[model samples]
Target: MMKVKEFMITDVVTVTKETSIKRLLEILVTNKIGGVPVVDAENKLQGMITDGDVIRYLQPKGRTVYDMFTLILVSEKEDLQHKLEYAIDHHVDKIMRKKEIFTVNPNDDLEAATSIFSKYRFKKIPVVDDSNKVSGVISRGDVIRYISTKLISDK
Candidate 1:
């Protein structure tokens, strides 16, 4: 049985919680990756951040409206420039998904990783050691490539 260690990408791109959101966005675009694992100084996995998260953060939220028989309340339109400036200056820890992170171990079976991805719809899973330190990362693309090249061959 193939193990996660055999297929995971060891050169994982990571970021610290203090990393600026602007820098994170640059990393994602330059690497062409959907997300990156958030780590600490010692490389311990702390959380995860994705391009989707950034997009959602930047998206202008609609103002709330409250109305009653004779009373109506509405919020004014938010300033887009202000919101963008705030988001870009904030740290990843402020917006990163810290709770309920889904991770796999390097020694775990490939099937385990695939199952997690399938069940949670995660594009990538961080491969950690027993100490919860990130050792590598495995993505859906990695699995597909492995299967295509190793499992199915022109014969």
Candidate 2:
């Protein structure tokens, strides 16, 4: 019965709500991670942001085609660029997922964390303290590695 603290990554990368989308993207790319937890100045968990969220936000809205016989298809390429620029300049809070965030406590059983990940299909889950402060993060990769080395080893 391992605890989350035994396997969670203590050197966690985090971001604030005021972080710009451009910076967020840079962080994600630089860290080679899919998502990060958003914390406040006091280090309290505020929300979560992921590459998927950014992609969803940047996806173009549905266009309506009134006529089927239109010969000249005018595409607003500049409009799309402008929209992306605007979105990137905006803060992360604008697009971060805030509600129904799944988290685990450092003292919780590892099985509990595994259940959450399996049920929600989450790539990572933040480990918080009793005061709701992020102490670490645990990813699916971490769990898999632990299982491979500890449970299924041919000793």
Q: Model 1, poorest ten-residue lDDT window?
A: 70-79
Candidate 2, position 88, lDDT: 85
Q: Count the backbone clashes (under 3 Å) in each candidate.
A: 0, 0
Model 2 residue 94 distance off true place after TM-score fit, in angstroms: 0.6
Candidate that scores best on lDDT: 2
Query: Per-residue lDDT for 62-117 in model 1, tens only?
Result: 55545665444332235445577878979999889998799999899999999998
- TM-score per model over all chains: 0.86, 0.87
lDDT comparing candidate 1 with the true structure: 0.89
Pairs clashing within candidate 2: none
lDDT of 2 by residue, 1-155 (tens): 79999999999999999999999999999999999999999899999999999988887654544576775442556546767888988999999999979999999999989999999999899999999999999999999999899776866
List lDDT for all candidates, in order: 0.89, 0.91
